[model samples]
Target: MGIMKDFKSFAMRGNVVDLAVAVVIGGAFGKIIASFVNDVLMPPIGLLLGGADFSNLKVVLKAGSEAILNGDAVVTPAVAEVAIKYGSFVNTVVDFTIVAFAIFMVIKAIEKTKKKEAAKPAAPPAPSKEEVLLSEIRDILKEKQ
Candidate 1:
């Protein structure tokens, strides 16, 4: 029960909740970026590159083999193809770059806002009526002395 209560309190903390929200939003943002890269950005780039598809680009390291089965006897097993998928890596790198730039811009904007707020001078507080009266009395006392 105590552990449950502790967990509830921890989960309900402002920073923890904010982090969870950030994680969810970040995931959505990543998906949007991925869609943008794959659907929108890649097509134009591919067209510019003479209609080359990045996803399909790979270096076949080893050729795949088909399995041969005859009369419930397997002669050879099916082997999967091994390749270096550099095109997908490129797409991922681009996605990461865009996300990093976006986050950097957001942080920069936030910092700029904070700096602006901090740069403005705060207005001085007004003295209370009692303080004013006390000052006047003190002045009178000083003049008498």
Candidate 2:
């Protein structure tokens, strides 16, 4: 029970909770970026590059063959094509670039706000006791005059 309570406390800490929220939001943001890269960005780029589909782009390392059979009895199973899918890699790189740029912009904006806050002049400090006493004595002398 003590261990459970400790675990709960650790998990419910502000930093821990904030980290969890960040992970969830980061996952969703990644999906949105991937969709933008795959659906919106790639199509126009593909069209410009002579209708080449990036996802389907690959270099066949070994040519695959159909199942070998004798009298409809399979002697060998169907072999799958093995290839380097570089188009998917390209899309992934683009997604990473966009995400990095977005995080950079967010950091820049945060820093800008921090600088603005720091640049504002602080409120002047309250007068010391001696200054207050001095001012009161000066006012008393003025009254006498």
What are the candidates' C-alpha RMSDs?
3.5, 2.1
Q: How do all models score by TM-score?
A: 0.84, 0.88
Candidate 2 wrongly placed segments (more than 4 Å): 66-73, 128-134
- Which runs of model 1 end up more than 4 angstroms from their true locations? 69-74, 134-145
- Candidate 2 per-residue lDDT over residues 1-145, each given as its tens digit: 9999999999999999999999999999999999999999999999999999999999999888899999989998989999999999999999999999999999999999999999999999999999999999999999999
lDDT per residue for candidate 1 within 16-135, as digits (tens), equals 999999999999999999999999999899999999889888999999998999979998989999999999998999899999999999999999999999999999889999999999
Q: For candidate 1, what is the lDDT?
A: 0.95
CA shift at 80, candidate 1, in angstroms?
0.6
True lDDT of residue 83, candidate 2: 93
